[model samples]
Target: MAGMVEQVGPPGRDDITAYAAERTGGASVRVGALAPLTRPGWVQAGRHLLAGMELAVSEVNDGGGIAGRPLELVVRDTAADPRRAGAAVEELAGLGVAALAGEYHSVVARAAARAHALGLPFLCSSAVLDALTEEPTDRVARLSPPQSHGWQVYADFLLRAGHERIALATEPSVYWASGAGILREYVAPRGGTVIELDARALTPAGLCDELAGHRASALLLLAGHPEPAVSIVRSVRRDPRLAEVTIGAPAGQPEFAEWATLLGDEGTAIPFLRYLPERLSPLGARVEAALRARLAHPPSFVAFEGYDTIAVLADALRAGGAGRTRPAADWSRVTVEGTRGRIRFSRTPGISVWQWTGAPVQVVDRDPSEPGRFRVLHGG
Candidate 1:
């Protein structure tokens, strides 16, 4: 009683650290993981997801563990396929885990429905699809920015850049189409028109000819990947008239530098809401820093989403009493600043409620002033 002694548990548990240490002495807290760990495209995302979860678990164990039980992680590779995701979850559930986390692809999120049905806590790591939270369901919570947040920023960038007539290029895939739909919906009522383009039917040259014929002021490239988008950017650059048009892409990534080089003065990269300077959440930053430090590489937007997923699960576990967080946790006001800003839960189903946040979209004009650096034209 030199200073003060406090009891942290209901009964028989006095010292929190010591109690956790004793409880965790031999037992392991198992967490289920579902991600595409093998594919190169998903390599960074998968690693970052595991890295974040591992860091949180290590930090907890270092802090004397959760109720004295050391956290153990069980990961299953989903290979970025939705069909494989279900099998992976079944494998994890068979392992008898306390909680599950990590998901980069939306299709993988379908597994959460099963996890929810099983009364198991499903922590979303990287699934940005808004539909995940649209329906109110227990045991599933996301720690990443929803796709709608990302789409709003894309639309606003077009409006501010003086883009009047817009064209959309989107694949038939669910995620790509979902984002494209958001962009179209945002543009429709504002006196702006969205022209949908079919990738399969039209070549880059065909799109350029059509844009030239229509005199569209701007174009939004919403394809599934950068491979085709880059070709379109190149095609647009070739036509002197098309070069004057504003070009934007949702979630324009580092690969865009190539397009920037090709378009030269004609290109403009729309800032993704996820990459905005102000969108970085505190927990997201911590998770990002930890993963990058360990992997020796910067985490991409998708990778950051993966990291956010793990952090959310850890928080839920810590907030809930030892081994009591499955299906339900005391996360009513719990806020985790993920890579996309403050992520908070809502009562809605299939859509995890999040704070409204935006970032300045940079319009890069290769200049005599900066040479390589692209200057900010709209939101900075």
Candidate 2:
């Protein structure tokens, strides 16, 4: 919303592709988009991410675009596969997109590796994997808080909630393992014990049995959604022994609509991490309204991340297109007025990408009384 581009206009049409198409005419400055639009991916998160990105693209076009060239979004569905994502990055690079933006976690990791190798600037929209690339490089900058930071915040929330005996329902993944390790390390130093449950080997009922036997006060889901997550929640809620146990999802599974659509009332009160400020800036407020109108639902934090990703890239492109964003050597110099706040990137100690350290993080959940609403229980 700052720099050469103007603020987004008021919400009018939900169909942004049609709206963007009607107003723009030029060679077009294309920004390649990544998302898990299909199965094996969190499709709802992808949908929300795309909604925000699409809204930003439309707004960039309406503002006379970059150097009079219309801004364009070339989307590729990552389909939740790492190899598939790597291929997408290679293909997008070949397509001559000015930069890249995204939705998948591991999917983004794979894309990050390839993008880093090719020196393609990638503004990651949602992935939080700590080791996005094998080594440090300037080619990738991230909008989301990393797994270490966000999951540590979640661990603190659990500690404050008097949940000292915690259990993790973990699936096999470097991402999941990293998150669990973060929580364990943060919680253990404060006298909490973390138990790991094999989500792959255990049925929902067996998971519930393990939870009850341990007398664990809290259960954190570090597994995939719908399959084990939904079933685990259901089994735990139905079992009388686990009634008092707290349910958490540090991976943000409950943030999507389908989490509620599948689990319904049982899913309420299960806290998850979301990266949103307690209050939105005026720019964030306007974009939130537009995104809600476009999405026909309250936009998640991931949606805001998508919008901010485009916003940062657009500002860099306007300043100087490829020279500013192609190699991403200027990530430190990129300071754009994003929807959330002023966005800037810097090197973090453990992270490999140019990290936005200021993005807000919160622990929130659907209220049990009103399943449609979210209640902010903790924030950092």
Candidate 3:
């Protein structure tokens, strides 16, 4: 009988802590997707947006469906248009989604603000421009590092590389312009200056003339448009003086590779800051499979971001005692692990910063295998 006891499952190790899966229940939380899904230009990034949201949903469901009730997502395509974004928000609210995510473009973020005003919490994953946070609502939360943090990281990279004098090519849009300003603010205080070049409507001659005057050590592309940024890089690289300067960008879009191809082998050496490593995400793989399964191709960062936004919201809802009470933790303790990074909102200043969240900024060597892929050079 003693020999037959068989250890009894190793004495049960320890008591089981209640997992997130244990409590999720009925009255399914309706999570919404707000994005420019219809626009071809946005198609590249938007796919990643959706993947992030889907990943969160799928993972929650797989882990016993969030407090016993599975999450249901309501997706809305904003088509990169503000008017359409507003309409989609109305539609999702009508369907009664408990929370929402997505909307990378600042234009669409405004639409999200309207939805949040109506009581739905809008948790953004990809849209990081500071303007999005200015919208008054406790319902809005962002997981991505703000543009200021990203700018500082980029500036630090250039400065550390000994490129103290820099030239900037920036888009006129609030997102890029404000991002450039933030970069300048960070760079200037550190004894470096960033000269701005407004590329909104600059002719080739105008761009050349501006480039000719500056004895720049580095070039920073503050423009969001890949075409223009690539064009500038290609044009500048031809000039012997500019060819020697290091070119830096926030993130490399596939279009940057096209630009690299045009610029030749020299372009491959350009360094960029990556917010999220493409291959680092387990959810990214799942997102790609889902996109290929449904849409016949893999998704992009924007789509995965959209999916992640929803995933974070689902976590918050689950942690918030399923609407019973707020997830009451102090500012330092108030954190939610998000797809992009850990999210913690500041209680006093009442704005989000990368420091409190503990997200690392990485300087990466762009992947040779995939132009969009990257390997961490410093931080991970």
Candidate 4:
């Protein structure tokens, strides 16, 4: 999909006779796409992610269907469970999907990547964990920037904002721990200090007490959504002693529309990291409009990540990764003009998976005056 998704309307279908096969009474090149579709998972993010993948698949199929065979997406709901995700990866592989793509949670993606040790290529979509796998392999590639990369950007934003003494309210999760560690490492030498607060041990009120006692000007939420994160925000906002504190969620929790629906105007101005450029490319604009129609709301960067995942996979199939062992995660040959920018994979020193080095990273938040609008605070 070199100049990928140039036109974003209904994908035009080609010859149907070429689509005959044993399964579904038709021939389709299948890619198993995973997302957290049910509860305990971020459903809004999943919905947007799926929407983008679906749209891209439709376009790919319409655009002549990978050597005239229809492109198919076999989607499974991970539900934020690592074990379930591992199982899903096995099932998808058994069903003979040419490759695997899409997973939002880092922990769950790690599980799927582990199960994927069986040798199927996996193109990871939203997960940003630096160590996606316990060890590196040639069979996997990633779309989102790693935790270390994005967190460094967020840390830089914090330093520029003069929030040297920061408080990170965190849960006991690998993803959260990695993020907290990244912020601490990146901010410390620059004269910033990170204070860790155990969100699990601290009630919202107690967390507020800690924030006040520590006198931290900035508090970054590194915990799960709606529970501790939302609760902590509510408590901090209500506490008079913490009125001057700047609350942040660099984990991109505030990117989804549901965040706004849940926290309303209060969610505005709480900066979070998002993977979008300051301005959309022509292809991005078209995809963004199409995504809005499908999602019935503005699509988050996760949705664009999903769309770009398909665009790259489709291009890879065209480049011959559809054969049994040569799957779409082949980073060397892929050069997709994605919705955000040109997608190309390379090895950075610390990142384990084949990573797209050019995905744009930004720190943005909903405008306080107009909660529906997003304002970019920093970009890197």
Per-residue alpha-carbon lDDT of candidate 3 for residues 28-105, written as tens digits (9 for 90 to 100):
555667666554335556655665566567667677655666666666677667787787778777766666667767
lDDT of each: 0.60, 0.82, 0.60, 0.85
C-alpha RMSD in Å of predicted model 4 compared with the true structure: 4.7
Off by over 4 Å in 3: 1-28, 251-267, 277-307, 320-344, 348-356, 365-375, 378-380
Best by lDDT: 4
The ten-residue window of minimal lDDT in model 3 covers: 1-10
lDDT of 2 by residue, 77-121 (tens): 777888888887888788677788876676355454577677678
Candidate achieving higher lDDT, 3 or 4: 4
Instruction: Kindly provide the TM-score of model 1 when superposed on the true structure, using C-alpha atoms.
Output: 0.75
Candidate 1's residue-wise lDDT over 103-140, tens digit each? 77776775554676655677776566787744566667
State the weakest 10-residue window (summed lDDT) of model 4. Answer: 1-10
Number of the predicted model whose TM-score against the real structure is largest: 4
TM-score, every prediction: 0.75, 0.92, 0.75, 0.93
TM-score (C-alpha, index-matched) for candidate 4: 0.93
Per-residue accuracy of model 4 over 318-377 as CA lDDT, tens digit each: 887476764455688789899999999988888778899898999999999998999999
